[model samples]
Target: MKVIGVTAPSTGSGKTSVSLALLSSLNNSVSVKVGPDYIDGSLGSAVSGKPAHNLDRWIQGRDFMRRFRWLSSVYDFAVVEGVMGMYDSGSPVNLSTDYYFRKIGIPYILVIDVSKLAESAYYIAKGFIGRNCIGVVINNFYSEKHLIIVRKAFSDHGVPIIGEIPHAEELKIPERHLGLKTAGEMPDIREKAVHFSQFIDFSFIDKLKDIPLIPEDRKPLLVGGGNIYVAYDNAFNFYYGESLDFLGRIGKLHYFSPLKGEIPENPHMIYLGGGYPELYASKLAEKSHLNHALKTYSDQGVPILAECGGLMYLESTFESKESSLKFPGIFGGSVKMTGKLTLGYTKLNVLKDNLLFRRGEVVYGHEYHYSDIEDSWEKTMQNVLGKGIQGYDGLYSMNTQGSYSHFDLMRYGKRLSGSIAKFMR
Candidate 1:
């Protein structure tokens, strides 16, 4: 199998567009994010018609390579899109695309936006020459003339110009505060994928060599036996596919929408993920029956795992920019939709044995939100990496647990599954 990293000089360089386009160009190829991104898996899955995996170097560390190799072995080719710039390090760990490439000894392709450059684009490619750069893909080129000029300039600098994508308005992906919209929300994603594939040259990709695979020794088991109701809708759609996959392995999953006032019936556990809940605050608040059912479930000691937006929905009220809305009032707190952005990787040390974690066990996660919880409740996890709710996070009451941190269950799959099993017992 072949594994290649796609990176650019900086953000908004069309790395994601290029990666999806390349995946569309290849046969039997899968895509993955190099770090912990909440949206990539949603978008990548829409593009490739398969589930995408995240290989976070900071969270998974050297295990990323092992997991990556095992995942890549299942496909004919694997495309890993880098987060941020090519050489940009992590917030706390020295994990970057360059670091990953050198450590794993894999070749990568550089993507450069050449809409405003000709010969000068070669200078940008020159800096990444010896960093296992097999080739470069020029993005945002105007025409064939623009593509030819940039290709010749890079070829003269001993850099192989693998492909060139044109500047088209229709090829743009919609973006929000959290970056691009989920692939499910994007219109005609397959058509956009086709447009992106037309610009890439697959012949060069075919000539590249293969990388040896690493064996996967850890066997994933179905430790839990219960019915899980996962919140899935436009307002609460942020969840890792691997997490749901593990849930499915252990039990059956039933999907419901809080926006539509649907409640899960007789569920062993409820999962409320993160999304644009603040945007639909009034609608969520209007679902009185759903809110009451959730509260009653929590009151009855049915386990409920709530993330960022999920946590916001369980509060006393949500003060959005437009209006103040009421919530389930499970916890005595209010959430305010703020203009400031809070985003980073976080490590959570469990303060006590809870629904998703054991006492003293550390869980790595990502948090991106524009809302803040007001009242302090029983803190369940201590933040060791990013600033989370003034150093302490997670609100635990009865059998309900909520937090702003989005956990990657694949990192702690067995423990999480076992916890759910123990809870059901």
Candidate 2:
């Protein structure tokens, strides 16, 4: 498939908007985000009508290429939406999108928001122009005269101006503390993307060459797990596409909405991912049936994994400024919504055996949340790199495990599947 990346000079530079437009304009296109962002990928999936995957070199390492090849082989084209700035690194140690672009050998289009600058836009664009940069897309431009000045400035540079997007309020995606709202929340997102597509020149895609696919010999590792229930809704929809794919290979996936107080019957395993649970805290707290069911399942030793918002939902109460609401209470603690945002990549040293990881195993994941556990909690994993609750994470009760760290199945699939297999035995 012909692959192209959409990157920006900085965050909120219209990269997701441009990427969504490209996906809407292309045929049989699939999308991937460069980091552990769940919201942008959801927007891409909505525009493309397919599951959007994530490529985190820090988490997946060299295996990212294998997953990329597998994704390329399935679609006619792929649009990779970059995380943060093109060269912005998570840390001094972690690699960035520029590294991935060079390693994957794909050219990228630099997106620059020219709303605030006139002549300086060119200098900003010029700084980002590199070997892998194919062209530039000027976003949030004022008028014909504004576009003329920026175009004239770039006239000296050999790089072509692929597109000029006007400053339109309709193209903007609503944002909260986490980032852009999910595509489901914004029903007209696809229409907005289509509206944005009219401003862009898609002729560059025609000249892009195809990437050869590599053969995949990987096989399913888990066995004898009958049913795996996953929490999926507006409150709990933060999940990696590959993580769900791996689970589907091992057993049947039954998605239930915790907001509706739904729970699967006789579940072998349960997965509760991260999402805006705090937003729907009261509604979720009203689901006494789900809370009781989850608690009972945990008491029965059913393997359960919860991350971030999921971890909060398992706590006794969701404490907010208005009032405190009840939750599953599996962790016997209260989670209070905080103004302080905890966001970063994390490395975990597993202190105890869990459903998806073994004791002493080092796992790489990320944490992004605005909530903190109020009551003191027991911990199963030690945070070696990023911030954790007093250098500890992974709260476990019987067979249930909850943590703020979110894992990518591309890196943890084999180990996770094996752990599931062992538990089934």
Candidate 3:
């Protein structure tokens, strides 16, 4: 299979847009994001009509390579999109987009935004020119003269120009506080992405060599038989595709929307990821029956895992500019929308045993949210790394666990399955 990595000098350089174009133009292709970004992966899935997966070394550790190889063997072509800038390091040093692309032994294309500059674009591209760089794609260029000047400047360094994309407002995706609007919210995003994809020159795929497939070393771990209720909808859709796949292997994976007043029956475990619950606070608040059902499930000692916006939904009240609304009241605290943004990779020191983690186990995860909870709530985990509230996280009650960190359950493998097995028994 042929693997291509798409990166840029910085964020908003049209990496996702270019990735969508590549997926739209390619055959039997799937998309992969380098880090823990749920939004871009959703966009990729929308365009390719395939489940997009994430490959993060910090979160997945050595399993990253195994996941990459498995993905390569499944599809004819794969387009991996980089998180943030190409060289922007993660929690540890040298863990960047360029690092992963080089490690995976794949050629990457650099995207450059040339909307404001012409000849200076060459300097920007020069800094990123090195090993594994296949070529450069100029985005948002103005005119024929502008494209010509940028092309002429790149001739100095002998950097291959892959394609040229002109400026078009129609191609841009809308954004909110938490990055781009999800593909589910934008009904016509796929059509727009297909139209925008025409600008990319996909002939570069012919020059790339195929990566040999590796043997699948391990099988997916399955817990005891039971139904795992997962919250999925516009209000709560931030979940990893691979994680969901793993969940399905464990048991029956059922999806219900809290916004639509739907609740699962006889659930062995309940998983709530994260999303824009604040946007639909009023609608979610109206679901009194759903709230009561969640509270009853929590009381029954059913293992419940909630993160970020999911944590907000379980609170007594969610206060935003739109409205102050009531929720499931499982946490006995209120969540308020804040102007301050807490965003980074997080390391958690578990203070107590819970559904997803063991006591004293250190877990690595990512946190990106704009809401803050009252400190009066009980905390269960201490944050040894990254910015967590007052050096602590994880709200605990009965068998339920809630936190701001988004965990990649695939990293835990059998350990997670074992934890859920205990609850199932």
Better of 1 and 3 by lDDT: 3
Error of 2 at 112 (Å): 0.7
For candidate 3, report its TM-score: 0.95
Q: Find the 10 residues in a row with the least total lDDT in model 3.
A: 412-421
Residue 385 in candidate 3, Cα distance off native in Å: 1.0
Off by over 4 Å in 1: 143-145, 217-224, 413-415
* Local distance difference test scores for all models: 0.81, 0.86, 0.85
How well is each residue in 1-425 modelled by candidate 3, as lDDT tens digits?
A: 89989999999999998898888888898989989899999989999999999988777777888988887657888999998998898565566898888787878899999998999999988888777888999999889999999989987778888878898888788998999999889888778778877777777788889977684644755458678889988999998898888888887899998888988988988898999998888999999999999999999888888989899899899877766788999998888888788888889899877667778999888899988887467687889886666688888899888889888887754455665677677
Clashes of 2: 0
Candidate 3 segments whose C-alpha is farther than 4 A from its true place: 321-323, 413-425
TM-score of 1: 0.93
Clashing pairs in 1: none
> Where in model 2 is the C-alpha error above 4 Å?
217-222, 415-425
Q: Give lDDT tens digits, candidate 2, residues 299-357.
A: 98878889999999999988889898989899988888778999889998998877657
